[model samples]
Target: MLIENMKMAFSAIRINKMRSFLTMLGIIIGIGSVISIVSIGDTMRTMFADLYKEVGLTQAYISIGYWLDDVRQSDYFTLDDLERVKEVFGDEIAYIDSQSYVSADALYGRAKVKFDFQGIDYNYQDVQPVNIIYGRYLNEGDVKGRRKNVVMDVKSALQLFGVENAVGRTFRTTIYGSTDEYTVVGVYKKDLSPFQAMMMGQSDGGSAFIPYTLLTWPNDYFYAMRVYAKDDVNLDDFFGRLKVFIGRLKMRDAEDYYMATAVEEMGMMDSMMGGLSAAVGGIAAISLLVGGIGIMNIMLVSVTERTREIGIRKSLGARTKDIMIQFLTESALLSACGGMIGILLGSGLVSAVGAVLGVTAVVRPSVVLLAVGFSALVGIFFGMYPASKAAKKDPIEALRYE
Candidate 1:
C-alpha cells in the first residue's frame, strides 16, 4: 500500500516535472552551501593541527624588555639565565636556545639581496629544526670558535648566489656599517607556510642564520629565548613556573616580559577557525529555512491543483490518512533527491578547492547523513500543513467547485 501511494505521488510530480524541479532548487543550493562550508572548516582545522605538530607544541618563546609608556630596550638574556631556567625546570626542560636579529644586505659579485640576519646558538636547531638540503647546520665548535660561518635558507641562497647549492660561497655584508665577509656553510630548505616564513623574516626578501658570537649587537642582547620542554611536561604548569622565574630575575612582575607557547598560539587559531565555521554555517542555515518555505508554498499549490483528485479518491473510500501519506511521500522524495544532488555538488567543490589551497578536504560521513536527515525533516515539517489541508477537504464541495 505504501509503494502504491509513492507511485501515485511520483505520477503527480511527473505531471509537472518543471515545477517540481524548480521547487527542489532552493533545497539543493542551501544544502550544497552548508556542506561545502563544513568541509572547508574541517580542512582548515586539520591544516592548523599539522602546522602545530611541525613547529612543536612543546616549545615556548620569551622576549625580554622593559615597558614604560611603550616597550623599552634592555640588555639581552645571558647564558646564566638559560642555565638557571634549566636548573629550575630540571628534567622537565629539554633544551633552551636564544636568537637575536640584525638588518644586513648580502652582496655576492653583482647580485645583492637584503635580508634579516639572525644570530643563533648551536642548540637553535633542537628547538626549531631546519632541513639542511645543501650543507651542515651550526655546531657548538662554530659558536665557540666564533667562526664567520652562516647558513642561508634556499630562497636567500638563490637570491644571493642565483643557485641552490651555495655552500662555501663567500658573501660580504655591512655589520653595523662595518664590511664583513662570511662563508655560507649550509643552505636549509625554506619554510613551507607564509606564516612561518614571515615569522623568520624570510618572506620579506630572505633571511640567514649565523653564530651568536659573531653578532656585533650591543653588549650581547638577544631578541628572544626559545625553550623546549620534555614531552611529558605540561605547558600551562611550565608557563606558570617561567612567569615566576622571569618576575624574580627582572625584580618585577612576570607580565613585564612577553612570553608565549606554541600550544597557546595553536589554541587561538583553533578558536578563530571554529568561530568562523560556526558563523558561516549559521548564515548558510538560513537558506534551509527559505528552502523549507519554498517546499511548503509549492505543496500548498499542488494540493489546490489536485483538489478534484482528492475528492474522487475520498468518494472511492480512500481515508484522510491515505491522502496525507501520499502527499508527504512526494514531498520527502523531492527533498531527498535535492539533498543527494547537493551532497555530490558540495563534496566535489570541496575537493577542488582543497587541491587549490593544498589542504586535504574531509567530508565526514556523519555530516552527510545529518544533511540528508535534516532535509527530510524540513520536508515533513513544511509538508504537514498542505497534507492536512488536502486530507480535511470536503469531497462534495471539491468536486462541485472543480
Candidate 2:
C-alpha cells in the first residue's frame, strides 16, 4: 500500500513537471547556501591552523615594559641579557632571537629597490629556518665583527641585480640615518604556498637580513625577543617562570613584563572566525524557513486541487491515515530530491572558489547528511495541515463539489 501511494505521488509530480520543479526551487537554494558557507568556513579554519603551525605554535614573545612610566634604559634587554637567559634556560629552550626591523632602500646603480631589513642574531636561523640558495646565513663572525653584510631573498636579489647569484654585490643603504655601503653575503629562497602567494601578490622586492650587531651597535639592546620553547616543555609553566626570570633580571617586578604566545593567538583567531561564521550562517538559514513556508503553501494548494481524488479514495474504503501518509511521503520525496541537487551544486561551487582563491575545498559528509535530513523534516512538518485537511474532508461534499 505504501509503495502504491509513493507511485501515485510520483505520477502526480510527473504530470505537473513544471509546477513540481518550481516548488522544489526554494529547498534547493536554502540547502545550497548553507553547504557552501559551512564548507568555506571549515577550509579557512584549516588554512589558519596550518599558518600558525608554520610560524611555530609553541613560540612565545617576550618584550620589555616600555609602556610603563618608570621604564629606564635598564629595562631594555641587551645582548648580555639575552645570552644570560639562554645559558640559564639551557636545554629547555629550542631557539631564541631578538628580531628588529627597519625599512630602507638598497641603491643598485640607478634603481633604489625597497626592502624591509631585519637585524638578526646567529640563533635567528634556528628559530625560523631559511633556505639558503646562493650563499650562507649570518654566522657568529658576522654578528661579532659587526660586518656591514646582508642576506636577501632570491626574488629581491634578482630585482636588485637582475641575477640569481647576487652574493658579494655591494649596495648603498642608510641604516639608523647613516649612509653606508653593504655587501650581499647570501641569498635565500622563499617558499610560499599557493594560497600564501595569492595573498602576497606579485612582489619584486622582499625582506633583507643583516647581523644584529650592525644595527644595534654601541647600545646593542632590544625591547623584545622571540623565543621558541622545546616540544617537550610545558608552555604555560615555562612562560610563567620566564616572565619572573626576566623581571628579576631587569630589576623590575614580574607583573611589569608582558609575554604572549603563538598558541594563544591561534586560539583567539579560531574562536573569532568560528563565531563570525556561525553568525553569518545563521542569517543564511532564514531562507530555510522561507522554503518551509513555500512547501506548506504549495501543499495546501495541492490538497484543494486533489479534493475529488480524496473523495473517490474514501469512497473506495481508503482510511484517513492512509491519505495523510501518502501526502506526507510525496512532500518528503520532493524535499529530499531538492536537497540532493543542492548538495551537488554547493560542492561544485566550493571547488571552483577554492581553486580561484588557491585554498583547499573542505566539505564534511556530516553537514550534507544533516542538510538532507533537515530538508525532509521541513517538508513533513509543513505538509501536516494540508494532509490533515485532505484526510478530514467529507466524501459526499468533496465529490459533489467537483
Candidate 3:
C-alpha cells in the first residue's frame, strides 16, 4: 500500500516535472545555507582555539596601565603588582613570569645582534611550559644578584659562533646606556617567532631570555604578568581572586586601570560564533517551510486532478482513512525524495566552502539527521491539510465533477 501511494505521488510529480523541481527549490536553498553557515563557524572556532593555545591565551595575563577616564596610557603592571599577586594567590599559581620587552644591541665576542630582548624573572619555567635541550636556564640567584647572564636561541647562537655548542662563550649585551659582557649559560633548540628568527630558516621562536633584575627602567617600569593555573577549575577561581587581590592593591579603579585576563574576551568570541550558527540555521529552515508548502499545494492539485479516480475508489469500498493515508504517504514520499537531494547538495557545499576558508569543514551525523528529520516534519505538517481535504470529498460530488 505504501509503495502504491509513493508511485502515485511520483506519477503526479512526473506529470509536472518542472513544477515539482521548482517547488523543492526552497528546501534545497534552506538546507544548503544552514550547512554553509554551520561549517564556517565550526571551522573558525576550532582553528582559533588551537592558535590561542599556542599564543598563550589560555593562560591569564595580568596587565597594568594608567587610564584617565577615556584617555589611556601604557604605564602599567609593576613589580609591586607581582609582589601583591604572589602574596594573594601564590599557592594556586605554578609560576610567576614577569617580562618586559626592550630593543638593544648584543655583542658576542665579534658577532653583533640588535634585537628586542625579553627580561624574565627566576620563576618563568615554573609558570610557563618550556623544555631546554642544551643547558640550564637562569635561576633565582641570577635575577636577585642582577647577574649579567643570558640564554641564547639556537639561531642567535649559530649566528654568533656558527654552531650549537656556544655555551660558556661570552657576549657583550647592552640595555639602555649600560653595556655588560655576559657568558652564554645555555642555547635553546628552537626559537620560532617571526621577530626571533628574522633571518634564520630553522629557528622557531628566537629571542634571548635575560634576568629581570638586569633591567634598568626610568621612573616607569611595566611588566607582562602571566599566570598559569594549576588546573581548569582553579582557573575560574584564580581570576576572581586575582581581581580582588588587585582591588586591595588599589589598581582596580577605572582610572589608571589594568586589563585583567583574556578569559572574557575568548568567551565573548565563542558566544558570538554560536549566535551566528543559530541565525544561519534559522534562515535555512525557511526553505524547508517553502518546500513543505510546495508539497501541500502539489498534493492538493493532484487530488483535484484525480477526483474521478478518488470517487471510483470510494465507490469500491475504500474508507476515508485509506484515502487520507494514501495522499499523506504521497506527500511524505515527495518531500523524502527532496530531502535526499538537499542532503547531498548541503554536504558538497560545506566541504567546498571550508576549503576556501582555509579551515576544516566538519559535518557530524547529528547534522545530517537534523536536516532529514526537519524535512520529514515539513512533509507531515503540510501534507495534512491537503490530505484531509481529499479524504472529506463526497464520493457523489467527486464523481459528478467530471
lDDT of 2: 0.84
Q: What TM-scores do the predictions have? A: 0.89, 0.92, 0.71
Winner on TM-score between 1 and 3 is 1
The 0-to-1 C-alpha lDDT of every candidate, in the order given, reads 0.81, 0.84, 0.70
Question: In candidate 2, what are the lDDT values of residues 1-402, reduced to their tens digit?
Answer: 888878988887788788877888888888888888889888878987887777788798887655688777677788888788899997888877775777788998987888888888776777678899998888889888988899999989888888989999999998888999999999999787877665445355567888876666336577777788998899999988988999999888988887889999989988998898888778767887788788888888999999999999999988899989989988887777778788888898989878977877978999999999998998898888888999999999888766
Q: Which residue segments of model 2 deviate by more than 4 Å?
A: 1-5, 65-67, 197-204, 217-219
Instruction: Point out where model 3 deviates above 4 Å.
Output: 7-18, 46-58, 64-75, 98-220, 250-256, 356-360, 400-402
The C-alpha RMSD of each candidate to the native structure, in angstroms, is 2.8, 2.4, 5.8
Residue 123, candidate 1: C-alpha displacement in angstroms: 3.0
By lDDT, highest first, what's the ranking? 2, 1, 3
Kindly indicate the candidate among 1 and 2 with the higher lDDT.
2
Candidate 1 lDDT trough over 10 residues, lowest sum: 194-203
Residue range 247-304, candidate 1, lDDT tens digits: 6875666777778888989899989999998998888788878888899999999999
